[model samples]
Target: MSDYDYVIVGAGAAGCVLAYRLSQDPANRVLLIEAGGGDGHPFIHMPKGLGKILFNPRFLWPFMTEPEAVSNDTGESWARGRVLGGSSAVNGMVWVHGEAANYDRLAELAGADWSWTHIRQAYCELEGHQLGDGPARGGKGPLRISLSDYRSRLTEAMVAAGVAMGLKRAEDVNDPEDGERVGYAPRTIWRGRRQSAATAFLRPARRRPNLTIVTGVTVDRVAVENGRTTGVEGRKDGAAARYTAAKEVLLCAGTIASPAILQRSGIGPAASLRSLGIPVVRDLPAVGANLREHRGIVMQWKVDDRLSQNRDYRGVGLVRSVLRYFAQHKGPMAGGAYDMGAWFKTRPELPIPDGQLLMSPYSFDYGAPSLRVEPSGGFNICVYKLRPDSQGSILIRSRDPADPPVIHARYASDESDRASIPVLVRYARRYVAQAPLRDMVIAETRPGPEFETDAQIFEAYRRFGYGNYHACGTCRMGSDEDAVVDGALNVRGVQGLRVVDASVFPFMLAGNTQAPVMAIAWRAADIVLRESR
Candidate 1:
């Protein structure tokens, strides 16, 4: 006898979507387990309250990467949401579905089902866009996608600057036809609240009698018998608990936790498993390999105090902003992380946009212990190489489920990645020095004009560069021999087990990952349904 038809680990963006879709059929008993608690915090709903929610221990799983040569021997804090919606609840509400070409490449590696055509259709079914229905955009769906209602003169000037530099002014940043364009960013914020996966997908699913949501349960490992996952074993309320899955066990625990969970279950590299004194269930070396993240550097410029939103974030201004939010849900309190976004090629010779930029009207002191808004008026721009070839790994330190995984984010390790630092820095400088932005001119606050040469700029990046928190590819899916999961998202050497979520991505997408993760889950549900029949 089984406790559920399907057992889902982690209630993040992917897990929420899976729970909802799988439970749509009343006959399927689905159990969704989360290590974190509920998403009832007011900060989780308030769009601009990300700063408050991100560092809150109750809602976050703060994992730090091991120090590497490229990052000046300093560990970087890699935080993911520990709450119901996972990172989607704590993330900067940016909504982007990357380029169609990226999905086309996945189709090449995986199968036709993972192609752009299918993924686009899944997106159309997932979104509820405020811009209304279109051939490409969805209008009536669960996830509400909307443009940020908040605007700033500085952000408008940044878009103008991009247009003057020959970049297309995009109406929809996610539109595939808008190549090399700049525009106000689209976000997973509807009305005034953050439309996280918990809010959009799981809320409705919670009403289903067949769906069971168990939180604050720490999953130890999958209970496998004779190479087939029968269920999952974990600790709940300090007591041992086990749940069985008659159909399948789905691991949607994001990139870090999914791989860690597999390794703990003796499903990773044979050598490592032996060293950890755990009998190897499968000798899958790629279980925790190929970790990828977007590395970017921030450039801040001191602008006129009136043009920046710095004041709205501090002291009395913050109090007023709070009141305004409750009264009308309008103001900085309703804004997303970035005001504007752009995709561009560093060099004209490149066929696709190789770089991405995000602009915010407010600046933060990056070196602060926690994210602290600057007292002075300023704006910041973050520039990143859309895709880098550098790879890393995640390994378990101990068998204890409470222990955090060892993360090795080998940023800027590749020659090309290192070379792009100078190119990106120089490009950002040039972009800000153009048109109307030049008139609103100010001095570069961090890594200023003194860092003119390529070497100097590269050094500046080493000091200030940070991961964009878009980590993936640890449990990569492919048709290759060493791939952890196959084209249909099934574990290579196991039965009744699947690894969904960003962990299965063979490569990282060029933009924010939330949208793609949701789409992947939506498509995976169809695969699971077809296979179950």
Candidate 2:
């Protein structure tokens, strides 16, 4: 049997970083386990490959949400990456740090360690930004955050329109203290490749003798003896295996799998464990509670001007673009899913941005399950509630580790979330009516011309809205009675075990979760190392 000082349960964002940092000391041994295969797929490195892996069975997990009641009443795809980097490998690479106030809020909820001040220091040390280096940004760090080289006139016009509406231009969206987050953004892409956590943190540490990287390992449960996590039990190549953690078994299985794993291991709600025929180790109802996702809906338009990326994504141009990506690393394929976006409050008096508006110079064919761009040049503006009051969950259906969970997203459930839908939609519609876009814009394809009233917009949201893929707070962090993890992120009612992924987020961010997750992983590393063996 193989054993290590630290057994990280997933080779995702936080797990990879922990493997790298913990193995930094020559005496410490680390075992990094991954359920997915090697990161050899070409789709993983391309910035625009999100469309390729969004529905791919090999890259995406088989899990999805349960039918909702309030929102679409349908099971929207919960695209968690079954790869080395986790969702970061398949994400759009939008590197948003979120509002400082949001981090401050999380700090208040979890602990002082999660404060914006400490998080700011972690961000400064963990990122390697392309723009330059200083207190506001990282100069020489493992992760790469760079501005996209691809810029289309339509996206430029979208920015111009937002500016015309009196929105302040942000110098850099990734800048922490930047007064305005309402503008175009610099993404987390390196050169022409995607900067996933696997690429940024894991790759550099792979050669360490103390760090053992194992793939095709499905960790089913954490071996708990007398309420302390001793190790992890799983399967590899259809053969059962178990590995002990000398220090701690870190569950970085992400927002969805982390809680499910806990449930399967008998550490979750007693009812859930009994239903699965698993003996309850700890009766924690908070294991899968407080789940939240940023609510989003798209507004598409068919522009008279054929300036969108839709043209480049079809027919011969598609093949040519692939070749161009391999040859020059500068083409339509080098950019991320989004081109420009802005964060603003529905009501200006709010402390932080409660709404987000992202624009792309292309629309997709959502009529089918596949992600296909439109045949003609069209544009899409995605509006979302950055801080929705609604919460959702991911609960296991059976004792089988391979079984998908019952995800109840209940999107836009709260009165506040429902009320903000129209405001966000109307803001995008107004932005589209501004100078640059109004002149070339033809017609609204989605929510159509009839959705003028707030009620109509609410219906549109229910008909088409989906999660922003920022599902978090499942294994909530805090010292509260309902908290699954304590202030130090250690799983409540269990010793020698901890959660260090997006699942432990005390609350949701005002923007994307990638950048914040990295910073959190960096801080988690510090906390883990301070322990005496």
Best candidate per lDDT, number? Answer: 1
Give the least accurate 10-residue stretch of model 1, judged by summed lDDT.
170-179
> For model 1, which pairs clash?
none
Per-residue error (Å), model 2, residue 355: 0.7
For residue 97, give model 1's deviation from the true position in Å. 0.6
Clashing pairs in 2: none
For candidate 1, what is the TM-score? 0.98
Q: Which tens-of-lDDT digit does each residue in 1-533 have in candidate 2?
A: 43788899888878888888899998988998999987778888988777877768897787778877655677878888888998889888888887777778887788888888888888888888887686557878898887756667777788888788767776577556534355667677888898888999988999889999888988899999887888999999999989998778999999999999999999888987797799999999989888888868888998754688887787888899989999977788888878787877667677666777887888887785667787777899888877667888778998888888898887777888888888889888888999987887888888798988988888888888877788888999986877999878898889999999999886776478888887888888888888644
lDDT per model vs. reference: 0.90, 0.83
TM-score of every candidate relative to the true structure: 0.98, 0.97
**Largest TM-score belongs to which candidate?**
1
lDDT at residue 432 of model 2 (Cα atoms): 92
Query: Can you tell me which runs of candidate 1 are displaced by over 4 Å?
Result: 367-370
